[model samples]
Target: MASYECNRDFPVEIIPSSCARHSIKCRKIIVEKIRRDRISNSIEELRTLLQTNQTNQCPEQPSARLEKADILEMAVQFLREQASSKSNESYQSGFSHCLQETLRHLSLHAPLQPAEREQIKRFYVHQRTSMHTRLSTEPRAQFCMPSKRHSTLRVRKSLWRPW
Candidate 1:
């Protein structure tokens, strides 16, 4: 390909010879090597991560040499476990929050007696426990959020009170 070069004072035009094809091929090889190096380095990093996780989980067990496929499999398993635990934690937290809100609102506005409220609280606890046990036995659906995007919004509360 013909190309041009620009200096501070003037523009210079240049043309390529037949060796351009060889040069282009060499560049492609170099680029491919670099890409392969990146992939290998990332795999090594994952291997180390998996080793550390395994060691942490079982200190006395010796770590064996891992193949690339094994490393990838273990990494996938680890990620799934992490995601599942996070999801379960969020679900439990949300349920607890709902229970608290329900109790608070009932205390303020509901005409039910204290004994009835206590009975409802016991029912909530029972449901929470049963759901937790059920979830522990079954694989819950996973919903993944994009790690890169998050909101940090601040809202201004109105001064007017409904109460």
Candidate 2:
């Protein structure tokens, strides 16, 4: 095999020897070394990858220094954080929703007449207790999960006063 030009896209320069086979052999060895070196073994490589991912789209194919296990671990941690954040958000939303309903009902009634006020208070207290109990007893992983539908109720107000 006669010596030929190497592909312009290759990052490392393979010495253009008289024989193309020798150049190809050298390139293969270089790639092999890169693959054998894990990102965990080199702090610099890990930093560079983290920076690249944070800044922009990485090149079409990154260096083989990034191990499959490292990538999988990162993905798992990200999903865990996402789940925890979602649980907190759902819990807050449910609590706020219960409060909002209670307030809206009371507001519409204006000044409640004692018995009616007591009834509304009891209803709100029951909802609050149920929410608190569920939040406390549920597993951390399952805490504060939203319903499958993920829908919110919209409130429309005050079109009665002639826009």
Candidate 3:
């Protein structure tokens, strides 16, 4: 029986009697090399190429067609909570800005149907009244008082007198 060594590039020193073992090693090496080359290519470049192709594939904005009354109501509730807490001013400003942007987008792209708009208005009114009641009843609720400058503009004299 003539023992055959694997093809010239692989220094596979052991000469196997079966052809199956030799082919498996050769195929594995080829697959591994292809995988390594693929990994070496820049992923960012591939992403950019894909994005470029997709740039012209713009779909209509969801706000253009979908009724977003529920979404708007949720945003209003979130804003009210933030306002009541009186947390970081910058964060509150950013949140409000984003909410406004979303509303603007919805108005431009997906205007709500007349019925949906009415529902949204009703929901907002109900939410406001509920929040007011909760704030008044909750003992731990800390009401955010306006700054002294703002307060002074509304009143002629301090309500509390010095003892």
Candidate 4:
């Protein structure tokens, strides 16, 4: 049977031979480098320990945070792919139109804080303007235009419009 030490010390040289060739002071350099490396390694080890402890203490799913992050990232990538794949004029126009509609829908239903509400309002206005521009450029696209009532109504009234 072989015995193994979990925490083994390794010899590390902090000063390079080039420092001696340049006649630079080596002792202080060596001490400082060693200290810096020690502190860095300690911090990394502490972080690993903390992460391990957190995982071990949790009774629920181990990778919930990672999974959520992955899902969000995947959704973003899917949106990007869809946007990038629309090379044709009609596809680009239609995609923008649909995006504007989705944003408008989200603004109506999503629970938003005051600041978030302001941000959403700004985005909605911008998207509406972009939608108008796209519709102006391509008048034949029926689905891209806001309905008569929706186009005339104020934002508040538009919010009340049935889904």
Candidate 5:
């Protein structure tokens, strides 16, 4: 039987080629087991996350057993919902800032009666409320900017007075 021995070892045991091949196979199996363990641990962690972050649990079976595929699908859906909510919040914040600036400009520069100013304020408030409601109700709500003709600040010549 052909044997291999390490020169570095003080007490070298003759290792047959068959034994060497078997050792290599054992190492491969150990490595594969470690890889599988890591994957299993990761999936377990994901399962815990899905359980904790479940806001709208199913009414039928809230504590039902979830398959790996179900957990993954729910995680994807949760992440997408989170992303959409964040984007909508950002959009609403920007819209609010613009509305405030517009209102401030009108109050400072535009010559209008108290009733007219109140009317304009109410109109904008209504629009903002409607937008918020729509965004909350619709999963895929799209915001379209007003046309250029409608969006531009057109101060009537009569309303503008240089004091």
Candidate 6:
């Protein structure tokens, strides 16, 4: 493969231990204080959004150990909603930002299940195939003919060899 000739090596460097933790801690504490003052963006809010049956004023504490299965299921619904509402860019962006932030916080404290990796892979594939039609077509164009077979042919080609 001639892999050894490729530029894969890295130049090593050393740094003082204080350079890493202290600055990060200082920045985090500053942001953390501001967050305490704000009253928006809570896990309870997400649980409320995801739950269909529950009323707004539930007097129960949620389990801190949220299951990966539940999270993945909710994520599937969220992504589907985003993928379907392709006309609205702002809504999708806002939802994506919120989702990423929530996931970042959760991932720091919780470990994902072994099955979650496969779940994520499946989601990626689904989104890619389904969104290909919407994203590949030109936007802001005049009315065009709706040829069903044209789209299907492209999809089949992608499915066979996406290389």
Candidate 1 lDDT at 65 equals: 88
In angstroms, the error of model 1 at 111 is: 5.9
- State the lDDT of candidate 3 residue by residue for 1-163, as single tens digits: 3434556554555545345676777789899999877754544344444334323332221222212343333334435645644643454466456755766787799987889777766765675565455444431221122134543542343122335
All candidates' TM-scores? 0.56, 0.35, 0.26, 0.23, 0.59, 0.26
Q: Enumerate residue pairs that collide in model 2.
A: none
Winner of 1 and 3 under lDDT? 1
Instruction: Tell me how candidate 2 scores on lDDT.
Output: 0.53
Which regions of candidate 6 deviate over 4 angstroms? 1-87, 138-142, 145-163
Question: How far in Å is the alpha carbon of 129 misplaced in model 5?
Answer: 3.5
Q: Rate the local accuracy (lDDT) of all candidates.
A: 0.64, 0.53, 0.48, 0.49, 0.62, 0.48
Error of 6 at 39 (Å): 54
Q: Tell me the tens digit of each residue's lDDT in model 4 across 126-158.
A: 766765575344322211222444334433432
The sequence of per-residue lDDT tens digits that candidate 5 reaches over residues 53-129 is 54234223355567887776666756665786797789778878897888788778977788988898898788688
Better of 1 and 6 by lDDT: 1
- The weakest ten consecutive residues by lDDT in model 2 span 151-160
- Residue 18 local lDDT, model 3: 45
Give the clash count for each candidate.
0, 0, 3, 0, 0, 0
Q: Give the candidate number with the greatest lDDT.
A: 1
RMSD of each: 12.9, 14.7, 21.7, 20.6, 12.2, 27.5
Task: Give candidate 1's error at residue 49 in angstroms.
Answer: 1.0
Candidate 5 local distance difference test against the native: 0.62
- Which candidate wins on TM-score? 5
Q: For model 6, how many clashes?
A: 0
Q: lDDT tens digits, residues 1-163, model 2? A: 4535566554454534433676677799898888777544554555465436533433444445545555544444435646755775596588678777877787797966889767877877886676566444432222122222221211022111334
In model 5, which regions exceed 4 Å deviation? 1-20, 55-61, 131-163
> Where does the lowest 10-residue lDDT sum fall in candidate 1?
146-155
